[model samples]
Target chain A: MDNSEDTERIASVLNGDISSFEPLIAKYQPRVFATVRRYARREDEIEDIVQEIFIKAFRKLATFRGEAPFEHWLMRLAVRTCYDFLRRHQRNRETNLSQLTDAQNEWLERFHVSDTADSGDAVAARELVELLLDKLSPSSKMVITLMEIEGKSVKEIAEIMGWTLSLVKVRAFRSRAQMRKHLAQLLKECPVTVEPIKTS
Target chain B: MNTDKLWNKLVDEVRKTPSGHSVPHDFEKRIMDRLNSTDAHAKSGDSSKIRSLDLLWSNLVNLARQATPNDRVPFAFEKRIMACIDVPLEVVDGLTLWSRAT
Candidate 1:
C-alpha cells in the first residue's frame, strides 16, 4: 500500500474501525518479524515481540502527526521496542565458554591460530558472533547489530533510535572495542595447541 | 594477525549467513485477536472504576493545592530534619503499584 492508503487506514483506526488495522499488519509483519528475529532466537519469543510491537503501534497510532511516512514512524517504534526487549531478556541471553558448540570452538581455534585464517563455516561463525553479541550489554548489542550487521549508517541509527548522532558514534566505537575484547578473551580461553617450530 | 582483522573477517562471515526465518502463517490473525481481546477486557467495567478514581484524585489534588499556604515559612526543626536527610521527601498517591522485575 502507498502513503495515502496508510493515512486512510490510520484515520479509520483512529475513528474506531478496529478491523482497518489488519491491512497494516499484513503489510508489515514480515519486516517486523525480520527485525525481531535479529534480537530474539526462539519462535515463540519472536512472535510475542512482534505481537507486542503491533499492539503498541495500535495504541500509539493517535500520536502520528503525519510529519513522516507511517512506515518510518512504525519502524522507529519497532526499533525502540526491540531495544526494550533486549534489555528485558538480557539476563537470559548470557553466554559463556561452556555454552559454545564444537563447531564454534573450532572456528575460534582457527582464528586464534591465525587472524588471517578463514572462518570457513559460515554457520558456525554466525553462531559464534551471536554468542559474543549476547555477552555485550543491551545497548552495545543494539548498536553493533544496527551498525555492523544491518549496515545502517550512524545517522540512520540515530534517527531510528531517537538518539543523538554523537551518542551513536560513541556507542558504535565502544561496542566494536567491546566485541573485539570479548573475541580476544574467547580466543585466549579456547584450548588450541600450537605447533612447535622446527630447527635445522 | 590483528584482532581487528579477525573481527572484520568474522563479521563478514556473519553477514553472509542468511537470517532464514519467516513470519508464521497466522501472525496477523493472532495480533488482531490480542488487540480485540484487550479492548474487550478494558470495556468490561474496570476502566469506568479507574476513571472515577482518577477524577476523584484530581479534585483532591486541586483542593490540597488551594489549602496549602504558599507564604508559610518552614519551622526550625523541620528545616533541620530536611537538612539531615539528603533525599527529597516523596508523597505517594497510593494509586501506582511498585513494579516488580519479570
Candidate 2:
C-alpha cells in the first residue's frame, strides 16, 4: 500500500485496531532493519535495536500528527535509536592521530577507490568502505550513510539526525570529499581500464 | 564535473553498494506479535464502564437529534427506558441477595 494508506492504517491501529499494524510492519521492516544495521555491529544487536524502535514507535503513535509521512518519522526514530546505541556503547572512542598503522592507511586508501571500479571489485570495495566508515566519527558516518546510501535529502537527513540543514550539508560534503580523496589515491596506485565501445 | 553531478554520482554509487545482511522474515511477525500483545493487554485492562456508558449516551443523543420533531420519541420510549433501568435494578437486587446469603 501507498504511504497515505499506510498512515491511515497506522492511525487505525493507534485508535485500538491492532490488526492494522501488520501491514505496516510488512511494509517498513526492511527499511527499518537496514537503518538499524548501518550502525549496529551484530545481528543480535540489530534485532534488539529494531524491536526497540518499533516498540517506541507504537508507544508514541498517539502523538503522531501526520504532518510528515509516517516513514519519515520512523526513519527519524531509527536514526535516533542508532545514535543512542553508539552513545551507550561508547563505540566511537576517539582515535589518536599518531597511532595510525600502515595497514589501516592502506585499507582506507582502498575503500575510497572501490566506488569507480568494475563489478568484480565491488565486494572488496564494499568491505573496505565498511572499514573506512568504522574509522569515521559516528555522527559523520551516520550523516553520510543517511544522505548517500539511503538517498535522503538534506532536509530529511537534518530531521532524522536532528541537525540543521546547513550542518547536514556540510557534514555530507566533507564526508564525501574525504572518501573521494582516499579512493582517488588508491585508484592512482592500482589503475583499472574501462573498455571503449566500438561502433559497427 | 559540477558538484551537482558529482554528488549525484556519489549518491548513485552509495545506493548500489550492497548491504551484507538482509532483514529476517520473522521481523514483521515479531513486531506484529508485540503490537497484538500490547493491544490485547490494553483492551483487557480497559474494562471501564464509564467510557462505554459515555459512548452509549452520546450515540443515543445523536440518534435523538437526527429524528424529526414529530418522530423524536417512539410510542414505547418511556416503557423502553423504564424496562432498561428495571433490568439493571433487578440484577443489583439479585447480587445483593447472593452476597447476603453467602
**Strongest candidate by TM-score:** 1
**Candidate 2 chain A lDDT trough over 10 residues, lowest sum:** A191-200
TM-score of the first chain in candidate 1 relative to the native first chain? 0.85
Complex DockQ, candidate 2: 0.01
lDDT of 2 by residue, B9-101 (tens): 876676566775444546669999999999987875454322332332232223323321211222433333233323422445877899999
Per-residue lDDT tens digits for candidate 1, residues A39-70, read 77777777677777877888799999988999
**DockQ per model, Cα:** 0.01, 0.01
Task: Candidate 1: give the clashing pairs.
Answer: none
Interface RMSD of 1: 32.6
Q: In model 2, how well does chain A match by TM-score? A: 0.70
After superposing candidate 2, which stretches have Cα over 4 Å from the reference? A92-116, A173-200, B1-102
> CA shift at A168, candidate 1, in angstroms?
1.3
The local lDDT score (0 to 100) that residue B72 gets in candidate 1 is 21
Pairs that clash in candidate 2: A112-A183, A113-A183
